[model samples]
Target chain A: MSVIYQRVALIGLGHIASSMFWGMKASGLADEVTGYARSAETRETAREIGLCDRVCDSAADAVEGADLVVLCVPVGAMGAVARDIAPHLKPGATISDVGSVKRAVIEAVEPHLPESVHFVPAHPLAGTEQSGPASGFAELFHNRWCLLTPARADATEVAKLRRFWKGLGSKVDEMDADRHDLVLAVTSHAPHLIAYTMVGVADDLQRVTENEVIQFSATGFRDFTRIAASDPTMWRDVFLSNKDATLEILGRFTEELFALQRAIRQGDGDHLHDYFTRTRAIRRGIIEAGQDTDAPNFGRGAHSTGRAE
Target chain B: MSVIYQRVALIGLGHIASSMFWGMKASGLADEVTGYARSAETRETAREIGLCDRVCDSAADAVEGADLVVLCVPVGAMGAVARDIAPHLKPGATISDVGSVKRAVIEAVEPHLPESVHFVPAHPLAGTEQSGPASGFAELFHNRWCLLTPARADATEVAKLRRFWKGLGSKVDEMDADRHDLVLAVTSHAPHLIAYTMVGVADDLQRVTENEVIQFSATGFRDFTRIAASDPTMWRDVFLSNKDATLEILGRFTEELFALQRAIRQGDGDHLHDYFTRTRAIRRGIIEAGQDTDAPNFGRGAHSTGRAE
Candidate 1:
């Protein structure tokens, strides 16, 4: 409810940063938030929309006197931004990142940060497919989990960052860096890649017109497209940065798909039925946890009772 | 609107059948709708819910004098139901089905039907993850596409069936049986198996506890689970019945997934970004087609702006 950070610097003006800015403003979590983006157009849009107290021309300028400088750029750009802003960071400031891949982000950014600053790797597990300065709101992080891979960061600083994220309306939890990457690989990265692949396959299939696929997509393919439509640069960096874990989970996915494919080919109804039934229970856990809704078609459109496809 | 059929019979009491019953009742599409389910419990639930004018103890009894008898059972069970009710179907009645796969359904049901009865196979491209008699609602088919694969049925009967679906609040389209199977394979079947495979992989991973997957699944994996959570018996029959197309699309899916996986392995950002970016256009088409909303998370929960995961 009160100011948790006197000065917060956001080094990217996309969905997460703009959302954090709005969330902070809505909750009165910070005194001033300075923002910067690689694209001048993005900075202009953020400024026009009043996304932050100050929209700086450069990452270094944004971090000049900020006590909390959060790297909100694509994972691949984290190191470069970190090196660029190292000299300009305020004394004893805490440097954190909202990257999907934690181990790689810590590896990419820690060496570039000055010893005076604290480096806490955090990942907020929430987002819509849309990405842009304007496509964010205060409710983006409401009831969402923000996992912090503090690694060896000072306990006090980690706690402070946790409090700040809490103020931004996220439930905070601490996780080991490698574990965080692996968990996210299963939860986000691999699923995203699979969705992208499925959507791409549909697009490439000449036998089925794209119009037909689009027209009949409401049941299943539509959900995959919403996920596959997420910001390309950010997802590209996620796969590359979290390559091992994502590939591992995807390997398992392919193996399972092949088995199910074999069952379908063999007309093994029981095998298919058992596997399908087993997976249903997992969704029950998610709905019970309030991580998702149990509404039909996600209670969208006409079936206005529950959650998504 | 006047009743399209003087007496209608729904042979199964499940999500689609119950919903159709309610939909017809809401619109007065049929004068008297009779219902029967193989499961007595389901029939009891339908009777309790006022699902139909009469709850018959047998499929034959339900179809005794019905002008339109709909088989809303799983694809694999269609042939048996068709055989059981063949003797009792009225001389000039129209028989239809709401199966996801059409080619196999036609082959299985056509031979059992008497030459006098018109058979017009149909599949509604709409549902929630929930199943059973209690899950049905009057608005389940509102504004959704109900695909008809009418293979050699009388034009008048086909038109009447289409009219009935329209009265039930659906947009109707006629597609070739084989083409419908392939189109649905791409849009629904393949996506479902892939989603199931992904969720299964998450479940089998011992290192990442189910709780972690449940808590962190809000963004990506959550959508997959909702899709994968669909009725197992229905999906099992679908895969067995639509074997060739499902396998073919999944083959393409595996190929694309491997290609994307390689891009991740080789750290090829351009390949990953291009594939991801290309897939995004498909969602825009789907949203524009009114097949789905652009609202975030299908306008569910807090982020009520656009569509699903």
Candidate 2:
């Protein structure tokens, strides 16, 4: 509930950064928070929303006199943003990033940082499909997991960053960069690619009109659209940066899909039932872990006790 | 809200049937509702939940004097259940079904019905992952679409069924059996297959432990797990009965996936970005149609302004 960092700089204000700014202010996580975005319109919007204590014109100015500078840019642009801010970073400041892919981010950002500064890459495994400055709120990271790929960063600095995330209400954990990529590939990246592909296929279906898909999407395809509706630029960068792991997971997914397809073709009902039953346990695990609600229908009408679907 | 049917019989006491019984009671759509499940345990649960006005031991007994007999069994078992109940169905009674697939269900049920009985096939495009008698609730079908595929049923009977569904808080629509199958294949069947495959791949991945997958699944994969956790027997039957349409859509999905994969491999950010942006429009369309919530995070914490993730 007190200031952990005297000054925090958020480079590239977007959903994650804007949320971080509001969350920090709400929780008194820092004394002063500054922000900078490449686009003038975004910076102007940030000012209008009072998103930060100071809205700077450039990344260098935002990092000036800041004890912590967090890169919230797309994965592909992390390096450029790091290079832009490196010269103006305060002495002994910690530079962390909120990129989805950890290994690529470290590769992209660490080299540009001065040895006096700490480079710790962190990824909060939390997001909605919406993006931009206005689409953020203070509690986006609450109860979410923030994975830190410290990878030999100074222990004290890593602990401080972990504490800062904890103060923002995220449970912090550490994992190796490569393992993080593999885990995220299974949990996020490949699933996103699959959702994108499914939505695209639905969009292209001539027999099933787009209006019909939207109307009848409540069954299952609607969920895919929600995932597919995420920020295109960020997701594009995610796939490009986490290419190998994502492709590997997707290859395995295609293999599994083929086996299921063959089972359907062969009328192997038993195989399909067994596979479906096993997957149910994973959902139970997610609910038990508090990552998702256990209420029926994804908690759609949980609060409205007598309401219809 | 007056009773539309004097006596309505539900032949399978699963999620759909039990929900219908409760929904009928909620809206006074049926004066008396009776239900029968093949499994004694399900029958017991129905009684325990007070799911029906009468819980019959046999399907024949359930349909003995009913004006409307709804077959709520899985697609694969419709034929056998229809054969069992056809002998007891009242003269002039409308026998409809709540199966997901239409053409196969009609083929399976129509041949078993007597000339005196009216066979009207319908598919409710609604459900949650949970199944069994206890999972049913009166509000399950509220605002959801219920697609009727009445091939040659009496117009008056079809109108009555549509009114009954509307009384239960559903929006009613009609389509040809073949088109229904194709639309559902795109909207439900293929998406489910894709979800099952993604979850299966996550389960089989050795490097990413099961614990990690479940813990980090708060991202896009969690939604897939919810879809994959749906009633296995019902889904198995759906795939087997709707094989042609499902396969066609899945093939198209594979083609689209491979194209996107190639884009990702070739570092074609433009293609990925463009595709992802197009999908966002579909989500907007769904929201505009009132099929889904526009609140951030799919309305997860929409009611609680500052709730944790």
Number of the top candidate by DockQ?
1
What does DockQ give for each predicted structure? 0.56, 0.51
The residue pairs found clashing in candidate 2 are none
Off by over 4 Å in 1: A297-299, A302-309, B297-309
- Candidate 2, residues B54-103: lDDT per residue as tens digits? 99999989999999999999999999999999889899999999999999
**Candidate 1 chain A worst ten-residue window by lDDT:** A300-309
Can you tell me which runs of candidate 2 are displaced by over 4 Å?
A: A297-309, B298-309
Instruction: Please provide, for model 1 over A1-309, each residue's C-alpha lDDT reduced to its tens digit, 9 standing for 90 to 100.
Output: 988889999999888888899899999888999999999999888888898999999888899889999999999999999989999998899999889888888888988888898998888887777788997778778788899988788999999999998988789999998998899899888888888999999999998899889888756788788888889999889999989999999888888888999998998999999999999999889878887666554435542221211
- Give all TM-scores, in the order shown: 0.96, 0.97
Q: Write the per-residue lDDT of candidate 2 for residues A1-309, one digit (tens) a residue.
A: 878899999998888898899899899999999999999999999999898999999888899999999999999999999888888988899999899999999888888888889888999987777688887788778888999999888999999999999998899999999999999988889988898889988888887899999888754787777788888899999999999999999899989999999999999999999999999888888877877664554424432110000
- Compute the lDDT of residue A233 as modeled in candidate 1: 91
Task: Tell me the TM-score of model 1.
Answer: 0.96
Evaluated on chain B only, what are the TM-scores of all the candidate structures, in order? 0.96, 0.96
Q: What's the lDDT for residue B183 in model 2?
A: 89
Fnat, one value per model: 0.65, 0.61
The iRMS of the candidates, in order, is 3.8, 5.6
